[model samples]
Target: MKKAIIVGSAISVIGLMLVSCSSTPEATTTTTRQTTVTAAPPPPAQTTTTTTHMSGSGY
Candidate 1:
């Protein structure tokens, strides 16, 4: 009975150690993207003109 208990304890401890020391899987791929935008042109300039008239007779 004592030998059976000792063997069982040893097996349990070895199983726990194996589980703790195992390696896990990881991701190895990466992705990236770039974008561009265009702006509109400015509006054109404006011009104005004025005229005046005079009479022959004075007040």
Candidate 2:
């Protein structure tokens, strides 16, 4: 009974080590996109002028 128990434990530890060393690393991926936007038109401009004349002195 003692020999059988020692053999079983050794076999279990070796199996765990083999399984841990056989694993492969994972891979990753990335994606990107571009977009364009249009600009709005400018507002209209206005101009106004006024003139006033007064006659009071002659020399």
For every candidate structure, what is the RMSD over all alpha carbons to the true structure, in angstroms?
15.2, 15.3
User: Backbone collision count in every prediction?
Assistant: 0, 0
Off by over 4 Å in 2: 24-59
Candidate 1 C-alpha error for residue 30, in Å: 9.0
Pairs that collide, model 2: none
Candidate 1 structure quality by residue, lDDT tens digits, 1-59: 99999999999999999887785446667666666776777667666666668777886
CA shift at 19, candidate 1, in angstroms?
A: 0.3
How high is the lDDT of residue 37 in model 1? Answer: 75
Superposed on all Cα atoms, model 2 deviates from the true structure by an RMSD in Å of: 15.3
- TM-score of candidate 1 versus the correct structure, residues matched by position: 0.39
lDDT per residue (tens digit) for residues 4-56 in model 2 = 99999999999999988777555657555677777776666666667678888
